[model samples]
Target: MSYKRVIRFIVFIALCVQAKQMVAQNANTRPNIIYIMSDDHAYQAISAYGYGLNHTPNIDKLAEQGVLFNRAFVTNSICGPSRAVMLTGKHSHVNGFKDNHSTFDGSQQTVAKLLHNNGYTTAVIGKWHLISDPQGFDYWNVVPGQGEYYNPDFIENGVKKRVPGYITNITTDFAINWLDSRDKSKPFFLMYQQKAPHRNWMPEEKYYHLFDSTQFPVPANYFDDYQTRTKAAHEQAMEVARDMHDAYDLKLAFDLPKDQQKGLAGNWQGIYNRLTPEEKKKWEAAYGPSIEAFKKANLSGKELAIWKYQRYMRDYLRCVQSVDDNVGRLMEYLKANGLDKNTIIIYTSDQGFYLGEHGWFDKRFMYEESFRTPLIVKWPGVTNKKIASNSMVQNLDFAETILDMAGLPIPADMQGKSFVPVLKGKKKGDVHEALYYHFYENQEHKVAKHIGVRTDRYKLIYFYENNEWEMYDLKKDKSEMKNVYNDPSYSKVKSMMQKKLMELKKQYNDPVPVVTPQI
Candidate 1:
């Protein structure tokens, strides 16, 4: 054997070993991430939560295959602020977006920026409602704000493309396309946001006629007079019929007088022009059959409101249908590309929405309907598919969980504790004995500023704006119909929870309960 040849062969083997090590190192470096956010979606609306009014087979399947957290909540009940919280892992105040009207300070450390710094490709598609344009994402395409359902304009990689398609389906398309074209060498993180069931409730053509005749059962508190609840049923502005007449003008007939229905000062097109030609045709088809069916059915005024409830529920669910269809497609795409095992797919909304639970249509109240979001995660590590954890989770935990699961560093500013332990079906962080909720209400509906804490058995809400309080024993009265705030028996419970709320405020740096309204 030649000594020179032996040395050359040994060197070649060493070089190969180094190259293989580098490849393995890269594989062990980071994981691909996808996070989807939907607007005005509720835990009740999803079949995964098991209320069972609508069919969300895909989202439900995600839960069946992965971990479904029963008690996920948003920091703020609104869109922009909630998103900011999710990104920064900080509260609305810390994130510099107290409300939807405020701007997002992206300079603060974020999950996207952290992932980007950690050498993962990141992208956000659909519904970037932040006052400033997005940052840290390698690629971004988002709707302007409360984006149009038809002929929506999207700011793509750079250029703007106005496409005539529903926002839900189109947003998923953008996300899936980005995933398909992402750098194969590096793992990626994608935020797929959707603009559906937000406002004016526009559904796709195929879904327009969905459940046109079926009667959706009336909510338990459907005819609630707002007797006990000052704000719960007092929102005359957001009601289906009243807003249709006054604020929204949905009640105005095509030939109605200009001043009354059209509004003499403002643009009338806003009321009539929201619908595209295709959408108009579908609207007629959808309402036409239902209205005629009503005439023959001969429902009186009270029965008529019941009919209206059914119609409204149907439209909202149909909009959800489009969202569900795309989720199915995205899941299918993962299988086709063999990205299923490597990918972590999640389905959730910006906040839990009200779906006629308490005769309510919008989300803002600290009630369970509006506060708790339905979260389903399908990660590759979990062995059990249909596992349900009663452990309480909140929106704050999201940013921490994502970073923690990725084996990345979470910033000091993040207020949320990581639920990665809960996801793996292990209790690492404290399994929430009581969760705090504070919604400083300032919006179209005008709910009041309130703070509350939810223990496993008791729920306490203190109305700071009005100095009133409400408490419920969730175990006894899950519907929260009977408020035991004034009951003499619960005084001790109320004080105990109030003390807990103060502790939470100190912990989270939330405002101390001031008697006088700061505003």
Candidate 2:
């Protein structure tokens, strides 16, 4: 009980405090990052968003633990371009990958390259549709293009090899495998992406009957005649009733007589053609009854439209269910390995999709369903817990935010402003007053090239190819049923929006290209 004994106890306590401080410092200095993206995953379908079409428990868990942005949008609402925007932190025009037809320039600076140079190991798995070998990752294994649902071939490290399994589950497996093998000493960034609920929605065999007993009500605007819309809407070919094929899309005409198949048999045979005999047997066993019933029903007109919508919803939601299941798998892996504590996890989509809205099933428009995407961010120690932010953010902001979170310098050339402050519930004001969008793909869906601006209460779009303008008061017309560009009551608002749209284009350096309408 002397001075030496007391000094010894004090020294032990100080050593313990020093070790605790060093642990906190390491956790803050180099936190790992995991960004999970789903193709054509709409905000409306997630149960957390309250649209009530289907449940996504894993995605909802991400929202429950972190910040969910209610107004997250995309710069361009297409597959390849949306990813390009996120990688480059610039609009599609600035990145030079404006549409699916174009190849991304690999030599350009990407966020991955930046992170890789700044002391972070980077990997991108699944659904890399950029049409170029991934340039800036320590490792990459991606699907070719709009990858198949069953037994898909993956381009792993530039070698094409067929992987045997459902696409979503296989993707998750590879992502976790990479995580297991990564260098533990260095922080890592992984883009675990998925291809599901995309066109010709194909669910895994296990979820074949998941939504069979559930009846989904048709969207009120599902029968929209495109009365108030412009030529862009009426001339498009994405109608669920007309464009969704029985053979390929709905998987119904496989049993019908080839002569009675309405000539769609040739176009859609590939989806079924890819399945092995055993896989095909399982798939048919699950869907055969519905196909037989549909053939016997003799549906036509509104009855046929409703029937097609329900089939579309069932298959789409089933695919989503598989995605949700895989998400849970990844979450469990992270938790089990003790990586959940210091890793910043993000869940989003390349862009939103139309779930039978406006009689359409594809995404290219500037409408709310396609333009607005789901964004959930979970930063273990930084983000506000279980909060939803109304601040308008975009896919463009993702790269800058990642760099910011990693304690790295955001390159000045990257155009996207980091919304990390918004995620932390700080600096709410000064978020952009309007978000700009531009879509350039014309030959695919017949939707004309367009540019527009969206604010909280209103949206203004210009169909440049058609030389038409459409405006909507979003507060009143969330469905975008009525375009009020020419309405006298909205003239003042239209003028202001028009000016703002042009200003945004200038601000983003997206000049409208001169069009010549192929002779």
Candidate 3:
């Protein structure tokens, strides 16, 4: 061969050797990741977050073992959209999940896809409510709709099947089942998302009597008037009282019609179906009077509020109990298989919720309750155990963090910076000097669609749709009860936040108006 041809062959051999070594390096570095998320599970609901209202021992144990993020937030504090953020590692604007109405564009580049390309086994199990066919999942079994209390329908492997089991139990069962069968050769990434403690809070039969006698405390801001809020605060039909129908699932009306002359049989539906015409008429008359009499004898004042609290909290806590118990089950499974040490376990919710805080039940407001999410990370040989980080972290940061953890390049398209630095105890003070929030397309349980920004201690929200602005010095008004934006003392603070907001908009290519609308 000629000298030039000999040189070309040597270069080709060198390239082949380099390619094989790179593949081997990628193979050795992948980590097993288990991500568990619950619906409407607030940071305050977790005992680790220091809320005494609920008991969450297993979840608390996670905080004891891993680093707990003091301040982690979602760009949008809703279900489907937040999940999209986690999957795509991008904002709603980029992911096309601007709201629940928009479906997930899974064909686009995703974290799952990236991980899968880098040789990680990926599976998503539980409530996949993107409202479209899921993508980037090797195996997926998810609840359809809000699912059910008794028999739930789960769409699995492209087939919808009715599983004769409790919703929370079944979702966890599927999650464990996936984990048990995961490929051990390559490290895995499993998304265990649950439909717990969401709307119409219902628990399994075993957990039905869990909180039978407990008097769950009412949220601090449960009786808030809409004096300083938007039309949404006054119009949303999700209030604890004054909004529920008598026949609603909660059934707190306490008026069951007793058979006047006879008694209800075991087969009430059959008995009623076979009732004689005259017997039916008598039953109706008796039932109407019985229900009315109970209604007329109203339970109001403190008595009524306590009843509402009991109903709301009992159901809520029961759902949480199921979720916590299932977490224990997953942990036990990991220990048994010897995967606990090498695996990184994360538990959190789609977004923080208002558990009767400020007289509200739903989220989506720029308030701390909705904006702040519960993020607990237990990374193998990475996170500082038992360290509680009070830095402000956004869910958007997860995209960067997850990719960086796996030693993959975080795409420039993802605006969220990596907090993996903070988790590893490399940085101090605030992670993000400021966090931006924008909520658009305002419908669901009726939370106002507004855009806002949160700094270390102060929050400023601009109600663009309503042309109103609210500013809060979070250190003083943690409950966010007072708006001091109009005060002369905060004019300087407001101006600075507004300028920061403008800088973020320009940086992110979002040009929101800074002009004040004429009232």
Best-matching candidate per lDDT = 2
User: Model 2 TM-score?
Assistant: 0.92
- Candidate 2: where are CA atoms >4 Å away? 1-28, 255-267, 513-519
C-alpha lDDT of candidate 2 relative to the true structure: 0.88
TM-score leader: 2
- How far residue 290's Cα lies from its native spot in candidate 3, in Å, is 16
User: Which pairs clash (backbone N, Cα, C closer than 3 Å) in model 3?
Assistant: 221-358, 221-359, 222-359
lDDT per residue as tens, model 1, 1-519:
699999999999999999877755664455566787889888888887878788989888888888887878776788887888889887776677877778888777889998888778899999989967888999999988778777788988667778876788888888888888877667778898889877656678887677765677778776656666655346435555333332232222222355654442233345345566766676666556655665689766667566656767777888888888988998899889877777887778889887766666778777788888878888876625787877888888888989987888777778888887887877844466677777765556767767778887788777776777778888888877878877789888877877777777778888645453211
Candidate 3 structure quality by residue, lDDT tens digits, 416-495 = 88888887888887778998887876765666677788899899888776677888999998888888878888888888
lDDT of each: 0.75, 0.88, 0.77
Model 1 misplacement above 4 A: 1-29, 230-236, 244-268, 271-279, 291-301, 428-430, 516-519
Please identify which of the two predictions, 2 or 3, would achieve the higher lDDT against the true structure: 2
Alpha-carbon runs more than 4 Å astray in model 3: 1-29, 230-232, 253-297, 511-519
Q: Rank candidates by lDDT, best first.
A: 2, 3, 1
* All candidates: TM-score: 0.89, 0.92, 0.85
